[model samples]
Target: MREISLAEMPGLLGQEVGVSDWITVDQTMIDLFADATQDHQFIHVDPVRAAESPFGGTIAHGFLTLSLLSAMNFESIPKIREQTVGINYGFDRIRFVSPVRSGSRVRGRFTLADCRFRGAGMLMTTYDVAVEIENERKPALTASWITIVQFDPKDRPEGV
Candidate 1:
């Protein structure tokens, strides 16, 4: 991940930050996600049954795709030089625009949308994120993702 000073945060707003490496969403991953979430609908876990559905085959759960943003962010977003940790604040808007079929690959494209000081030691950032499916025109999902970065005031850069 790239490292940046607090003073540089403002300049990144509305700029594309980074794109994550592609990740395969195969049957095993789909099955594991289903087991973890208890969402065993045929379209997500049963290939034979799902093959007859409108999707034509098993597809990943929307929540499963949404949850992937954490890993994607870690791999793509820049790190604040003074930040000690970052935590998910929640999403503002989320849309599952396309289904992720089994064995498909997906990656995240992130743009810094907004940033503000939430408190003395906390910074709130909003990112416009899209999960693109490999070789597909439409993205699997899009969202306004928010996160909070916690840092010590003493470590903050001058004029930040």
Candidate 2:
């Protein structure tokens, strides 16, 4: 996990940073997410119903995919740098291209899209993230997310 500063603009743009985990999209995991988010649609939680549905099996929730973005900060990418804080700015674009059925392997691919000055000890960086399902031609999800990762020595974000 190589970490750098936001002031290190343009240089990191388009760079493909490798995340640390090899995640499995299991049925138990999907069910857990369903329970947590109150999204227990049959397609995601009921094996019998989902088996009869078009998907042929239980699938992960789209929000579950979106939720993985926040999980990435802790699970996959480590803020190995000495930065004081990293804050979520927002999303530039987000799309759930394909279904992530239970019993699959997925990994995140990150491409730095834009990094610009956001003033007063902050830099806004846009990253294109793809959740690739193992052995699948199409990705499970695609998103462009923004983060203002700060290397400020004076103060840290309130929550951090």
Candidate 3:
């Protein structure tokens, strides 16, 4: 991950920040996610049954795809030099644009959409993110993700 000063964050608004390495959405992953979420719908876990559906085969759950953003963010988003901790603040919006078929690959593209000081030692940042399916025109999902970063007051950068 890239490291940047607090002063440089504002300059990144509306700009693409990073793209993550591709992650394969194979049957094992889909099955594991289904087990974890207890979503045993045929389209997500039963390959034979799903093969008869419009999707033609099993697909990863939308939430499973969404959950991957954490790993993606860690791989791609920049680190604030003064940040001591970062927390997920949840999404303002999310859309599952398309289904991700089993054995497909996906990656995340992130853009810095907003950044603001939330408190003396905390910053609120929002990112517009998309999970792109390999070789597919439409993304698996798109979301507006918010996160909070905290740092020691004494470590804050000069000039806001």
lDDT (10s digit) by residue, model 1, range 1-160: 6899787898899999989999999999999999998999999999999999999999999999999999999998888898999999999999999999999999999999999976678889999999999999999999999999899977665665
**Ranking of predictions according to TM-score:** 3, 1, 2
C-alpha lDDT values of all predictions: 0.92, 0.75, 0.94
Clashing pairs in 2: none
**Which candidate's lDDT is highest?**
3
- TM for every model, in the order presented, reads 0.96, 0.86, 0.97
Candidate 3 lDDT for residue 78: 84
Candidate 2's error at 49, in angstroms?
Answer: 0.9
Model 2 C-alpha lDDT per residue in residues 63-151, reported as the tens digit of each score = 88777767765566535254667789888788999999899877787777887655556666788899888899999889988988666
- Report how far off residue 158 is in candidate 3 (Å): 3.0
How many residue pairs clash (N, CA or C atoms closer than 3 angstroms) in each of the candidate models, in the order given? Answer: 0, 0, 0
**lDDT (Cα, tens digit) per residue for candidate 3, span 1-160:** 6899887899999999989999999999999998998999999999999999999999999999999999999999888899999999999999999999999999999999999986689889999999999999999999999999998987766777
Task: Give candidate 1's error at residue 145 in angstroms.
Answer: 0.5
Better of 2 and 3 by TM-score: 3
Let me know the TM-score candidate 1 reaches against the reference structure.
Answer: 0.96
lDDT of 3 at 145: 98
